[model samples]
Target: MDGILVGNRLIDAGEYELAIDAFTRAALDQGLSADVLAGMGSANLGLGRVHTAERLLRDALEKDETSPEIWNNLGVALLEKGEIAEAEQVLKRAYALDNGQSDSIRDNLRLVLAKTENSVYDEPQEQDYKLIRRGSSDYMIRTISD
Candidate 1:
């Protein structure tokens, strides 16, 4: 099987390390194509390496600007790293590229908008947090109120 397919499967299985290795092999074979970079980025994101994922996803975007999936993945990475404004913009692009057809992209966009709107709220003493994954690269953030 192709390394990109293998890497994506590994990511869906939540084997992030194996996915990274698969993506690395794919990158070596394909010379860092957008799909390979996106796969690597997704693996890193799954492993909680947000900064690395962001860089790889950005690279992927440079290689293929029209891919909504890449844009969505980058948005997720940015959101995880607390770059809310940029994430909102990235997700908006993804949503537009997809013509609002993808539920995952729509959900991510809504999550970013909610975060942007809620940023003005008074600080709570403490809040619970949740990381929700919709797909290999799609992430949704939720705050649990005490």
Candidate 2:
């Protein structure tokens, strides 16, 4: 199987370390392609290495700016790191690039909007914002009101 494909499968299975290794092998074999970089970033994000993930994702974006998946992944990393504003913009771009066809992107956008509103209002209530990972590279933020 292709290293990137294996890496993506490992990511879907939550084997982030294995995914990273797979992505690394893919990078070595493929000369640091955008897909390899994005796979590496996704694995890093799964491992909670936000800085590394952000850097790799940014690099991936530089290589291929038209990929909504990379933008969404970057947005998720930013959101997890509490960079809500940038997350919102990144997710917005992802949504636009996807033509609003992806539910995961839409959910992420909703999450960003909720976070932005929460920050803007400066009101602390009983709302739980949960970041839910969906499938291989999709994320959904569930808001539970208490």
Candidate 3:
């Protein structure tokens, strides 16, 4: 079975508690694609494991540093950790990487900025869905891992 498929199952099962371990295992075990890293990062982020999530996300980014998805997620992790400056920087990188991904990057940037300001804006209110790092390239794994 595909690592992404299995990872998605764990995520849907709300077993994110175990999904990271599973994803990490699958990725390393199979020498899988960047999707594996994305899944692991997502699971860790769900568990509020920012550092781990960042690591995984970085791995994904290193595989494809130009991917807006990776940059956006790194920004989100930094944002949630109250690293607004870092978050903004990542967001900018994401936006610069792909203008086509502007919506996601903008939304993520808005969320972090709002949190920083504690401003009352129309939040997404989509609790189950969050900004996860995805779509990184295989090449990005090396640089991001470091």
Q: Which candidate number has the best lDDT?
A: 2
Clashing pairs in 1: none
The deviation in Å at residue 86 for candidate 1 is 0.8
Task: Identify the runs in model 2 with alpha carbons over 4 angstroms from their true place.
Answer: 124-131, 143-146
Question: What residue runs in model 1 are displaced by over 4 Å at the alpha carbon?
Answer: 124-137, 140-146
Q: Give lDDT tens digits, candidate 1, residues 42-101.
A: 888888898999999999889999998889989888887778899999999999999998
TM-score for all predictions?
A: 0.88, 0.89, 0.67
Q: Give the winner by TM-score: 1 or 2.
A: 2
How well does candidate 2 score on lDDT at residue 28? Answer: 84
Candidate 3 on 3-115: residue-level lDDT in tens?
Answer: 66777677666678677667767877776456777677767776778899889898887676767766776777776665767887887787778774556566666655655
Relative to the true structure, how large is the alpha-carbon lDDT of every model?
0.83, 0.86, 0.65
**Lowest-scoring 10 consecutive residues by lDDT in candidate 3?**
137-146
Cα deviation of 137, candidate 3, in Å: 13
Q: Candidate 2: give the clashing pairs.
A: none
Report per-prediction Cα RMSD to one decimal: 2.4, 2.3, 8.6
Error (Å) of candidate 2 at residue 92 is 0.5
lDDT of 2 at 126: 51
lDDT of predicted model 3: 0.65
